[model samples]
Target: MSERSFRQTPHTSHDGSNSSRLSILLFIFIFIVLCLLARLVYLQVIKGPEFSQAAADSRTLSVNISPHRGTIYDRNGNVLATSVDAMTIYANPKEIEDVSSAAEAVASALGGDADEYAELLKQDTTFVYLKRKADMDAAEALKSEGIVGIYYIEDTKRVYPYGKVAGQVLGFVNVDDEGVSGLELYYDDILKGTPGKLVVQQGGGGIPIPGGTEVDEPAVDGQDIVVSIDIDMQSYLEKRLAEGVSTIEGEDGRAVLMDASTGELLAIASTPYFDPSNPSDSEVGSDSLKTVTQAYEPGSTFKTASMMAMLEAGVVTPDTTIFAPAELSADEYVITDAHERGDMTMTARYVIQDSSNIGTSLLVENYLGFRPLYDKIVSYGLNGQTGIDYPGEAAGYLSPDVDTWPLITKYNVTFGQGISTTPLQMARFYGALVNNGVACTPHFLISKPQIGETLQYDTEQIVENTAAIDPMISMLETVVEEGTGTGAAIDGYRVAGKTGTAEYVDEDTGVYAKSSYNLSFVGVLPDASTPLVCFVGVNEVPYERNTTEVFKDIMTEAISRYRVVQSD
Candidate 1:
């Protein structure tokens, strides 16, 4: 009877239990939602700065602002080597949406391979430099195309407007605007000014957004370098040397022009020279930097130094007579003149004019003892390095000590046999005699402080001997007028000079060989005022060619080009 009434009630307690279970599930869900909200709040508040900073870092861009490279000028302020502002193309590989298209565009404009450019653009890199140090015109042409992902950077490029005129001396720079060789390498720090930086905001693919201001540090330009090289003289010397070398058919030739009074190197030219603008194209072993760095037994050129020593030591006067023959024996070695001479008594002028090895050796052995002669050689700047502003300079070889002297050492040294010296040293030594016994240091840079101001440079007197000065001058004059160096004689110039022919030592056998010879000549013009002195060395002459003839052509051309004349 109670069952019928309960069925009608439909289990109210069970319904209440179901409602309680649903409430419990709702409470649990609410609790889970609150926990997630708390985590979101913690992340946004506690770790927010770190994430934001990371994002900012990703968008920040930095650009390098290259400084202007220094300008190279001649002594007269004529621009030789200069730097100009250039445009360079760069790319953000990550921003290149259409890698193939962008690379094809760039490759077409630059004459490179499209596949290689495309591969570069596919890299996951912030920057990929496409072309560096491009000229402004080329850069503008590329910019006009409006290629995507292509950007430009301003850089400085070293330019030699004279082409290869003074290329060897002026030097060259690398793609990054760094000095690579020549004067550029020697004075790199002074020529390369300080670089600056720019900070800007970048977008997701590493591309800088338009209207984004850049925080930039301006670059500093390098100072101008003025060299003592005369462009006209340099061009003339180059032309002459090239012609002479071509004519000799057996040897390479080089020449140097210097200011006899001040020892300022005016022009130094060597054949088979490399172009500074394209040094890679030059022959590897050619006379690239050999003028100052190369040393050889100077043959009779050293006779000038020996003559100066004899005069300074009072061992011989200009009129002092010395007997010369074909050969003379000193110790165990026999010294011979370039040409055979009979029993002849000649004056000091005659001794040098004939390039008499026998006479010069006798003066060294009988008159000026080993110590005095060696001291004179050292005093004339033979044993030390010339402090020229160049790289890879060498201190020429001299007898280490008198004790190490071989039996033939005195005789050999007398005629420039056992000793060696550089062309620069020879020029300076002879210049001292021509410039009133004041040996000035040879340099390439002419110091001109202010524009339109009187250009001034210091001169160092290496030797100061007044008594024996005049005779040395007379002897040098005789050399040009009626000496072995007669080929160097120029009309009305009163040329003072010396000639030399030395045997090159066989590198493998370590013995002197007659087959290979070095022909050299040194001369000073306008013997009165001594405005300029010149030295020339030609290497590896064959039997057919004469070294003296080469000297004549080079000297004549140089004198004519410089418009030099002897004083009245």
Candidate 2:
């Protein structure tokens, strides 16, 4: 090396640069180690439990177990509706290989459109329901197709034992096993039980892991409810109603039989009935429980309320006379009786016995007046709901302005034309007429008989004044003995009832139809301790061959069953 270059040698400079590089490398290595240690501490100490829980959750599968729906029984302990073990068809859309093919197979086996099932199977979620509460045979057929994503879940199906017997009153459940109408819908919360869950380890393909620990939470079954319905009586009523509806070529009919003393419903039947098991097959107007849901002008049957009001006011005695004509003009509207009885004089009792429209109208115009008559109707629960334990009950229409009410409204309401009422409401009101003037609230739930007990029901004294009711019952008794309700009489029993031929305004003309009539009859066994009150109404039927015989047939059976005897 040259002497001048020895002072600043390239080798010395290179050595210094190498030493500095090694120090920098060591510092970087130490810094990286510290960062690694801090990261380890954060993962192990700070977020360890949360990550572990997330991982556990990812592996666990939670499934809901449906509980058995409550059993519904008639008062005689016959099962009306009950839940049975069935299969619920479901799908794992994520696991499905071919949506169209799966949908086709499922729809073929289960009786639905392929397009609907395909849409359900194409969902982004892991689980989708194809059909809930499917029949075993159909669900099994679908399962046998060997579709990977298709699954079957154990579930309950509500089944009506008697099919169309008490279909309207008992109602039917939907595909999800939820009650949609009648007593079933009224007490749905009580009938539906708590659902439980099952948790187990799941694999990558959503299958249960081998030897995976399963945790279960058991479901609580719903409480059994015993209704005050008599299955035999219900069947009897339905048969008679259907026969009457058919015999007269009527549109439909409704009937209700009740224990007059306790206000407990014995039977409720409606014609053109639907099968509760296959509610979808029901006709448009036949699905409702007509006894409670359908309200119509009661026609001459409403004369009873006028009679009660007159009797209460002490304006008319049974022997008090009225001049009733075939046609009478009131409020410039001409009203007519059923038959042509040109200007005849009859007793007040005979007015009811004859179902005279003019006589009733005169009674309201003279003694009872408008306001007092309306008040009496209100007192009898005519203008309001009867408080029966049923859904969709109609509160009958009374004139909103009673004080300045038109004379037409007054005359029509007197004979049950302007006002409206349900068969159940009429039955309940008539119960007071027979039950010593105490109108009990009608109900179907007797008790939870499964627990060996009876449910307490509030029996209301809707009509406490017996002064009028006693005489009114006598009048009704006379009517059945020697009046229009003669066909309603039983052989050995003294029946008390009234017949009504109600008129309806034509849908086409908006005027009263001359041919259409709603024939109705209501009867009660006056001598029995717990009187059985029966009501029958046939809609759009001729008065000649309508519900009168049906009433007789039902009451005849009731007299035999209750052992009613003639004291006379």
Candidate 3:
């Protein structure tokens, strides 16, 4: 065979194999093209509505619709705290051109520093807050500038119309519209209403689409809260208490006035208080309320309890006589009267009138046994919280095992020296005394029944039981008439109360401070059947003067306000 013929045969066979391979490759390419075309058709037509809707949803932006917070009003219908319409300015940094120039223009309108806002506008984020709760006029002026990427959201800023009057009682809310302290924190749920939402379409580059499809859910405004605080009386009490603190050169002072008949708290004032409108500027310790929160030894004021217990237990009558000395050594502690006096026989009424510690110890140790006396004092709401509608109410500390009290504790507590009590607790106890043994729980909220609504809080609980208070009332009236509480007496009204001078322990050394005393006075006007109870306490003050002047001034104002008639 010729060589050319052999080479030609191999070449022809190779060409045939190559042709088959080309045909298969062409078929596979055509199949792939057909598959891709079918997929495109399916996406564009069969599932087009669903896919398009999903893509549109991805471009939509959701915004929170804030609700308007409630207004807080005092019992006299004075606005304490309310919300004002404001604006929140924001920017989409990505959409802004010339960040520096845009930031400056926005800052000029907002009345803010330009460099700070420029730094915010230089961010890579889609959104940044330029100013929160800006003035409405300022925000409107900025919007009128037609600056790109800047937007405004409607917001409500809390404002206190009566600045710093009841600041501690009416708490402040944070930037997020959350209550941080006082009544605001207590009624937060009722004040913060339900928030709604808004959804709107936006372009890929953070530009809002013109006439974009929007779904809106309107927000529900919060309900209004009316508290039982008498703004006028509250103001007066604050003024007097501040002056009293300054005059005594004391650490702090607190006062509470309550309607004895209904147990409605008229006023609760504390010195060194903070204005809730701008809580950021207030020091933490200054804002603390001492009336319901602080507890101290009640001193001679607790003698009323011992006297009452003796009368109730039949251990002694008003005329029952006891030998009282200047000093009586009981257990390891030596108990003494305010002033040195020779041993003399004194009635139970005289014992309280003179504020005699020795007489009180004799009555408790001999006449009224420890158990019976302790039980009687417990009945007066001494060792428990007064259930006031304020935050951080400390139930005055009392050892639970009063039935087995030590001799020193008994002797000290018999004259209000060892046991701790709050001004509120003492006021309630005295309220029970003046009300003839029926006293309601001290409360701040006056239950206002909205049409077809039930109140969230109840104000009717018997804090003190009906005991024979007529004799005690007469005895207390004698105290103000001729005893230690003369400074608390009104000209025409029959005032009943007791004076307290308690030595407090030094916080740093944990021992009794010779100079520091809590000078206090609690009084009640029992002229008519219904009484008005008032209590004032000054901390870390010398006992040169009692807190009777504050009580007198406050009660005089109260009598005029309530039109209290003078009794015989």
Better of 2 and 3 by TM-score: 3
lDDT of each: 0.76, 0.83, 0.81
Q: Which candidate tops TM-score?
A: 3
Best by lDDT: 2
Q: What's the residue-level lDDT of 157 in candidate 2?
A: 87
Error of 3 at 209 (Å): 2.4
**Cα lDDT for residue 150, candidate 1:** 83
lDDT of 2 at 263: 84
- Tens-place lDDT per residue, model 2, 94-206, is 78999888889998999989999999988887667898888899988998999986766687889998989988898877765567888889988888788877676767756
Q: What overall lDDT, based on C-alpha atoms, would model 2 receive against the true structure?
A: 0.83
Local lDDT at 482 for model 1: 73
Clash totals for all models, in order? 0, 0, 1
